[model samples]
Target: MTDPRQLAFAHRRSADQDRLQPAHHPVVIVGAGPVGLAAALGFAARGQASTVIDRKASLSDGNRAICWSKRTLEIMDRLGAAEALLDKGVTWRTGKVFLDDRLIYTFDLLPEAGHRMPAFVNLQQFLFEHYAIEAAKRTGLVDLRWQEDVTGIEPTTDGALLSITTPVGSYRILADWVIAADGARSTLRRLMGLGFEGRVFADQFLICDIHIKMDRPVERWFWFDPPFNRGRSALLHRQAGDVWRLDFQVGSEADRDAEVKPENVAKRVRAMLGEDIDFTFEWISLYRFQSRRLKRFRHGRVLFAGDAAHQMSPFGARGGNSGVQDADNLVWKLDLVLRDQAPERLLDSYDAERIPAADENLLNTTRSTDFIAPKSMASRILRDGVLALAASEPFARRLVNSGRLSVAATYDGSPLNTPDGFTAGDCPTTRPGAAALDAPLSDGWLLAALDRGFTSAWFCAEGISADALARMEAASARTTLPVKPLIVSDATACTRYGAASTPACFLFRPDGYIAARWRSIPPDAIAAALARATGR
Candidate 1:
């Protein structure tokens, strides 16, 4: 059997190459990696079309980002790619932390059991891109042009003009909006003369992907000062296809070439997995840690997402997961703007919300890096002491940070969110500016029922009253923006939203975040909240 990672996508010539004039598109996405692809699919979900361009003719190689968070999976589920990923990825929730050879503590990311998606899934980046590509194709709204390099960019009064190069020749294209999803070394960022502002750690880490026949439980295991690599930290994760990813904290002084050498990597693997265990090398690479991001995500007609906007240490699995969420947050706003349903100022909210999100990820990843690879003796001592006490002390265990895994970011003070109307009994998890919490309904999941649109979730114990239902129907009929009305009588879902006793109606944005909630459906309040949510 051939390795799926080695498969290359064919690059066919596009009609744009033969255009007499610059072809115009409503949206153009640079770099068809996971972020760009997801953005295209997101726009498509809102009845918008996009053109995606990538310099590479093939999907990413190697096992790049392997951990997909539940929030990310939910977003992908909305984009129609989650089922394939869930089928092929390893689902895990429990993680064990170790101090040397002794187990310190165990943690479960998702302790509750009502959600549809798992806590985390381990799948290769290539496979993720593959599934997203298929989803994009199914929408028929994405025009993917591989091996097309963006060479120049000119911001216009209404849009931007892009100079692209292909094997045949160069051509120009115009887009009302351009999304820069090109990786950390972004050509678009350079052309715009923008630079990232943050810290770059001196420590380096070595990643080794090995295939072996072993029966290890699907769980995250992190070690501090283990026997295999004394004085250094290590992480172990199980991936699909019997592949295991091992990350060892090799010091800054280690030679990049020497560390990745098969013999040297094998030596480290043998020490960790016992010399008797047989394994074959799949991939090996070394990376330096950095927690940096662009000062802003939006620049007039151009917007940045993924590595192009921010970068952080990989320990937390925040980089890829957060990038996908960036697409989720952006597309709905962009779609509304394109359709003239919202003011242009709504785009500013994307910067307002996502910048803080990037900062949060950077802060947490930086702290994780500092704890995992302490720079000074005092810091190392503090980390070690905390690890030692974590075995028995519950409070001390809270101090342990082995890449504080990725979680959905809450836009606590976003301008788009309306203040909660309920005096009490509102669910904290589904409060204004927070992502909608997934819960089990009588027929399907809450999120699936919400779908990809503005929703008015009416939670009541004995079903919606005729008066309330008639009011909600009238409100929906009056609004230009379609709001799908969902009547939830499920006990679990009603309790989750704090609508068991007091009937509540929660207005959700297209991105699945709470916009506003009311004790009863009021036509005027719904109109005002919708106006505020869309920046009218």
Candidate 2:
């Protein structure tokens, strides 16, 4: 087993370098979790600097979150941490669901190939934070301070006044914008008198990680009413370093403290694995969560991201993945606002986009929870009926809800999306407000071509006239924000993007979401759509 102390990342205390004093920062972030660190790195990617503070002196030792979705991996790729994460993560795409001793059905995520990242990778949250912190430090723009805590915050005419406590002494810092990423029990959200509204499930779960050499394949295995745990559900996953994560649903009547005891936990584990096998414990914990989110994510100059803004049960791996998307959505708008490129009203779109995303997560989690642990006898009977039919009937398999895996939510009615005027033959996969699809290019994947700004993919036919090419180039230049232009001529590339018609243009936002697309490249239409997208 690995020693937790040896795994701690080295972070120097800031108060020792200089005395605490009143200071001003363009942006300040509270908490140093994955979401917070991702936000700091997101700012640095856009040539913006931010100060980040955390209450702890070292990184978390526990393997809190282990599943990283493909969408989240793409975000990390842009922040310069995807390679390190991929090197240390166990990639998996298949999942098997079982009912008692019988196998029900299996599913595959991302069945097609040619994407840069996999469907999901299992890596500890601490490793994710470590790589993100390194990328942020390398940017030379982020000021990451550990062992510092925020005591209070008050909004002012120009910004927010923050009272902080450090190892040496207490001081105040002023920031034009503040990001509250302090987790579920956020101090800033509490201090602001904001409350999360949702129902708290009465069920409890026990999570344990162990070091063992097993012959099981690298795929997610979930059991409903298995022989080892006859009345409850169980889940198994493989992580890096030969470690395995096992979770068991202990009913509400079970004592939380007693369930986590080594003797009791060992008894249950021994029943699952053969008594002849040996294993060593790494970490264990008990948890109960609520599916909830704040009514408003923004309060004056302060904004909330990650757990601070919303939370849900971890059944579907939505918690960390959605939080990373939150950072991706907020950073670009915040950077533009700070640089006077967009009006302050642009920040409202952050709320408009992410709150709906949170609602979708909450909805899926609630459905998964109900299916896994049925509330009433009628619900249990219905669940068992579906499970029985799933073994033989293909139609019944669709009803199997073993956690609807997280897929990036599309902002269909977002104010930033410019409606497509051409309805005929418009591609739904690459429609406005949808996440851009990743495809293989001659050199690399399509997503690699995009930078930290708006980009236009102008697809031209094989023998386009010089006059039409000039018109397309001219239209790309007239956009409000500087947009990088890519001229795609390959038929495969055109077919993949659904740009079959000649002289088509697709505008992608900085975060890799399609802002708008046109079948024909009309300069006036492109300019107007670009203005609406950039909040002009």
- TM-score of each candidate structure, all chains considered together: 0.98, 0.95
Which ten contiguous residues of candidate 2 have the minimum total lDDT? 1-10
Query: For model 1, what is the C-alpha lDDT against the true structure?
Result: 0.90
Writing each residue's lDDT as its tens digit, candidate 2 over 1-536 gives 45433654445655433535568888999988989988998999888999998888677767889999999999899888799889989999999999897889898998987788999999888778877887888999999888788999998867898988877677788899999999988999888889888988888888988888999999999999899999789999999888899999998788988999988988878888878878988778888758889999988799999999998999999999999999999999999999998888888988889999999999999999999888899999999898989989999999998888888889878899998654855668778888887877767778888768888777664644666668777887887778776766656567767765655688889999988887777788777877887787
> Would you give me the overall lDDT of model 2?
0.85
Runs in model 1 deviating more than 4 A are 424-426
CA lDDT scores, all candidates in order: 0.90, 0.85
Error of model 1, residue 176, in angstroms:
1.2
Clashes of 1: 0
Pairs in clash, predicted candidate 1: none
